[model samples]
Target: MSLIEARQADPKRLIAGATGEWEIIIGMEVHAQISSRSKLFSGAATDFGAEPNDNVSLIDAAMPGMLPAINAECVRQAVRTGLGLRAKINLTSVFDRKNYFYPDLPQGYQISQFRQPVVGEGKILVSVGPDNKGRFEEVEIGIERLHLEQDAGKSLHDQHPTMSFVDLNRAGVALMEIVSRPDLRSSEEAKAYLTKLRMIVRYLGTCDGNMDEGSMRADVNVSVRRVGEPFGTRCEIKNVNSIRFVGQAIDYEARRHIAILEDGGTIAQETRLFDAAKGETRSMRSKEEAHDYRYFPDPDLLPLKFDQEFVDKLAADLPELPDEKKKRFIEALGLSAYDASILVSEKAVADYFEALVAAQPDVEKDGKAAANWVINDLLGALNRSALPIEKSPIKPEQLSEIIRLIKTGVISGKIAKDVFEIIWQEGGDPQKIVAQRGLEQVTDNAAIEKAVENIMRANPDKVEQAKTKPGLAGWFVGQVMKATGDKVNPQTVNIVIKQKLNLED
Candidate 1:
């Protein structure tokens, strides 16, 4: 509603300067490459890992007579991304020339948007943190605008001992610059905002959101202010690729700003670079205002206008986003908010969970069970190995089979983990592994009774203590399970030990 009311500032996040406490205000300008086969205007290839200049065209190379043409697919993707963000879609938007001098930009002035953008103000609800109750606190990050622009080629300075190299392969590629309002207050909120933003774009299929390969990056604008004061002069941190680096840069820059301001120094508005290795932000150049760019309408491009039907068609084909999926997991699938949030954070993880549920004969009965194994076991194991869900050693059906085995009493939960390890190391059917390895749970009543009797008779001293301290029955359960090679259900052993020792409930 209001600016101060809209921002969710944590009192603890306030910085303690020499004089008083200060707050960090952050905004983000993220550049995401559109997942298209060709560049935004030229017909040049847009594939990554291409040879130097292999993907360039005459227009991309700034040949004398080459003209630029709009790529309709890039327009569609920007609109789709706009709808995904729940932002307003302006039917009529214009592209302007961003005049700048760079070694990588073949065109003297880059074509971009200034006043008119395809997507207008929107909001993203980001869930941050596990507070005291282990719950994510939801905060809304406002999107200012999203505009389409052409990417500049990459300049490789480390290719040789002294000489530099320029690769035009990335030139003329499509890019969507999404600008966020200065609503972020802390490093935690900044990381959560970036994470949520990346997830949304990945879900929309607009961008791959791969920060490593430079498919997505952010230029962080950071400023510091006293609690009730107006905004401070902001510095732009250019081209931070990783989320961890973003947090690091913000932390370093915020403290730098606070140290300067607290020492009776005014912050100079400038563009800076985050030195990830040094963990600091260094000045790149003085910040340029809109007037400095001397923005004018691009002579080559026409005003981008589309009908409402185009937007409606794209909206109808959208997939179920993370928020909707998380709600369904909680309401219909009986998953906890924490579990559902983790599962739906990534599309692949959610799909795997859904597949496990679908494979079960009883969805309601096995939903929580599936969640436990997935989150606690599967995801845990993957994280330990530094592997992704797509690269998991165990598939959904294989995990489903393990759950099914436990459900059908073929194996105990303890033994199921053993079976899981076997599958992880050596691929095999869970059912066959249980049967062939003699790992099935010993569910026979008579066999369990015999094992309990033998264990009790051999440990008379412990049995005497068990009569007074019934909790000693747990020792007997462990012995019996160990003698039975841990194949018996633990619940069954606990019951047999209780009955044998005459322990109270």
Candidate 2:
């Protein structure tokens, strides 16, 4: 069963029109840099950081007679990503020239796909919101097209005090421009869609999906119309770099459109810029049509065709996607839906979780405890440091060792946290740390009884109070555990406390 179906159903319907029960329409254009060694039409390096114009080639600079040659590896990666998304791959696809004049465009026109795209018509299932008793809401968003294109160079606007510089390191790089249909209605839906898309692309290894590095960016299109009325004029919010900003842009634009209609004004179609600092979208330029760019097929490149066997080969080698891995976590590993979803959201995180479980002695029996420890303890540490799983100081084996210590009563939960901090910062074997620090749990009956006896003798007034009010026994128990530096098992303390105070057996 689908995640939403397996759990209780939520309100899937959109907000009744904001303006007299109006409906909101939304779409997204995501540009993800292709993972390749070189530029699309040139042998120049596709590295992100280099001196200005260091990676530019003769063709990339748009020399008068320089000819363009297609990169086969780029095409293969694009097709691989398309197949991973369960998209329709067009056996025959063509490239067209989109004419636009800008300083960043070394060439007067950009080579892109217009009439025929590489892939079309796919869907992705995205989980929204925080974990609730191991449950979350899942929504299926539609993919309209995934096309191949060349990225323009960067224009450094604020590098110096006076004139701006241009960087061609990113020029002519391969990009997979994935466009989504206007099936989204709310900002939350938009955020979830972008997040899930990033996860899928990262797992496929087609793109790094680093928004901070500008390797991935999104353009949000929003419009609002009265209930049962035709679609309203939409505005495109361009080049939003982060997922949080995408939600803010949509919300701001939607409310702006609604207020305009309410004031008896017309909503004009245009392109706008998202001012992240102010959390608003301001108009950039009037909307343009396809004829405005004067698009035409590039004569330098011939029509491209792919063999059925080739597409099938890439499909066979496709890694397990987020949705597939999530299902396996729930069905095979017996993890809750929420835990499975969090673990599978990133490739590294999921791999780390699997490694930890495999290193345990009783994985099948104690998998739930292992999952909780890794998710709550290790992940919490990595998050505090602002580091990814790959950069964590604690390895999977070390984490498993700590969990085993707790399981066998060699250490209590409170002491384990302290040991974890030592291991995390000082870099020593957990066994050695436990041995040297003498942080072992006091599970022996004689040792625990001696400590509890001192507490009962010193606090007779409290002991007398416990006979009548059993809850008061908790105070003496805390004193004893604190005296032992939290090395005593909490369950054992409760049993000894009841026995000493003459409460329940």
Candidate 3:
């Protein structure tokens, strides 16, 4: 089901107020910085952190007679991203000068796309539900267009009390402005859409999708209207950096609009800023119409045109995206949908999981035992240490060895965790650690029976209770495992304890 359908299925999704039920319409204009070594029109370095204005070139500074040159790599990345989104690619697209004056933009006019964009219509599928974690329902959001544009420089306001500092390092950097249709109905859907978008761009290597680093950001257009009424005028919320902030901003803005209309006040179409500290949006300026920018084709650059073969080659070389990988994990590997989704959320995690499984050829027959370990133990360890999967101390081969030990019954699951920690902290082979520590599971029937008998004799009262309540058999099993120092296989301990207690089915 699409997000709209899912929301319609849930009656509680409708917004309620004194006036009536209202529906929120949301659209997004996401700016993703192209991952290239140099600026779009100049050879200036595109490194994230540099001395202020150190990476600027003549073209970036808008020097006299300086002309803009197209970055072929940026164009290619944009086309790849468009294809990944399943969007239309306009082989021929023109660049126009967006007339806007700001201190950060040394060039009086920002060169952007107006009438023609490199990539045309596209759609992205987002998963939506409560907390975005229930049954996965696909929501197809329409992409209006994806256009290539230059980002303006930063104006550092805190540097000086009297004057602001202009940093041209980011000026003329290539950005893909991906505009979406107003199909979102709630804050959860908007968050899910942004998350899916970020995952796709990261998987494609088009953009880092690092909102904290300003590599990607969103301009949210939000408005509210009565159910079955015409769309209301939207107010643009500019430059929300984080996904959490996006959801918070939408909630606050929708409520603000609803309150205005309920109070007999008209909603103003204007630009707003989300103040993360205050958790609300404040008016920046009136929203501008297309004519306000006075957009026209730039005389310096010509229209971009490419052949079908070029696009075909790009499509051929595209990496397997998240959705495809998730599907394969579910079907071929027999993984649960929740587990597959978690593994494929990040490329690094997915690659690590694939490598781990590849190292253990019997992973498929084990019903994804390796996946459970990676998700529960390895990821838990990494998260506790505040480290990324890339920096994991345990390698895939090492993890595979650990799984092999468990599958072969060389060590119990409880003992394997100790081995994992020893290998993670002390850095030794898992098998060697198990051997050196004598952590092998005790499978001897005689030894296990002796342990179970000892436990029953010591806990006569508990044994009597076990006779009455058969579920208390687990308590006797735990005592056996503890007596054996957790080195015995839990299954063997359970069988022996059940037989000794005469509780065997």
Candidate 4:
């Protein structure tokens, strides 16, 4: 179902806000590391998991005479991401110094975008649903700006007993800081926004979208006010890595703000830290403004501009996005909205599904049935094994064959499950495996009649019970299948059992 159908089904329940008379306003500032070979302004390697300081360059460490130079690939990637988000790309933008103090920040200032960003005035659409049945509500989240920035070094505190260490491996790395307008109204919306952002960046290939490795992070801005009232004082929750934690931080911070206001206390404007263990936000520092950063144009680097032709070419090469693919799946492939939604949720899964569908046979094939098997049986097994679709031992063609076998009644459901297990582990032609193992269902009338006769002779009392109580016929069918090792097709067993017992259809 679409979000519209869901809302119409239960308008009051799903739309109800926990704040009662208050509205929870949320915006997120996401910092995604640019996927490139080198840092923004330095020649340092942008590889992760390297030795301390191995990826650092003289410019990254603020050497006296080192000069900054832009990475063209990083710039192109940032622009690509902006275009993917439907943001307007600025023809020109400047780099500024964000002055700050930290042990790992040897430069004492960070190169960042201020006043003018590379992208502006865009929107992202977010939705949520079950495997496929979940409804997608189109929440138009406004993008304020997307700027290019350089990340600071990492301070490692757990390395030694007393002295801490700094890892400059990540220092000077390129980052795209995408800021959003305060349009979200609840924790669910916050989650939806983050998820959609992750998908977009992943699709754009601007970032790897690996939250666990800190390739992406979000600074959640949350505030609460009485319904229809002007926005309240917002607090910034910094560096929330996971989508689930982002939603939790928003919920916790909004409630904290509301409690403070209800108790006649003013909500403080500050930066806070989310403790995943406590599930709450705690004060970090007073929120800094642009003046605190001492904003000024960088003397080492000049203003950046792009060739219009190059950008147009890049846009032309853009791949199919999640929304577009979902729509086409429904319209062209005749897939249900829910099914399409599931296939498009992740790029790899969608690719896998499409590859199988592309090779689908025209004769005696059920496209929707094939989709159901892929979605439920195949995906369920993959999840249970803690593997991705790419890692599944069962190839698309193999799974497609299994679906065909079940459709042709060449095997019973129980027998098909066994065949799937074999294919999942042994990795062979599914039909050959079924043949070698004698796994095909015995659907012939004579075979089923023999099994039914043997079952009735052994259970004469149960046969009498089934004749009197029609529902008890199913019990006789189960006995016959058990006696025949379940190779007998279940439907055929049911037919022969009913015939033998003189039970009406």
Which structure among the candidates has the greatest lDDT?
Answer: 1
The reply for model 2, stretches above 4 Å from the true place, is 1-19, 131-134, 159-164, 363-365, 501-505
Evaluate residue 113 in candidate 3 and report its C-alpha lDDT on the 0 to 100 scale.
92
Clashing pairs in 3: none
All models: lDDT? 0.90, 0.85, 0.89, 0.83
Instruction: Using TM-score, rank the candidates from best to worst.
Output: 3, 1, 2, 4
lDDT over C-alpha atoms for residue 167 of model 2: 84
User: Cα RMSD (Å) per model?
Assistant: 2.0, 3.8, 2.5, 4.2
- Expressed as tens digits, the lDDT of each residue in 266-363 for candidate 2 is 99989999999999999999988789999899999888898899999999999999999989888878888888888988899999998988888864
Error of 4 at 74 (Å): 0.7
- Which tens-of-lDDT digit does each residue in 1-505 have in candidate 4? 0011111122221223343556677778999999999999988898888889999999999889888999999999998998889999898999999999998888999999898888877888877544244666666778888999999999999999999999988889999999888777777878888888888888778999999989999998887766545667888999999999998898788778767777778987899999999998899999987788898999988899877887799889999899898889888778987888778878888888887776568774565776787899889998999998999898888878887788788887777788889888888998999899888888778878987898889888998888789999888878877777778888878877888888856
Residue-level lDDT of model 3, residues 15-106, one tens digit each, is 89787898888899999999999988899999998999998999999999999999999999999999999999999999999998999999
TM-score, structure 4 vs. true: 0.90
Listed per model in order, the count of residue pairs whose N, CA or C atoms clash below 3 Å is 0, 2, 0, 2
Candidate 1 collision pairs:
none
* Cα-based RMSD of candidate 3: 2.5
Compare the candidates by TM-score and give the number of the best one: 3
Error at 80, model 2, angstroms: 1.6
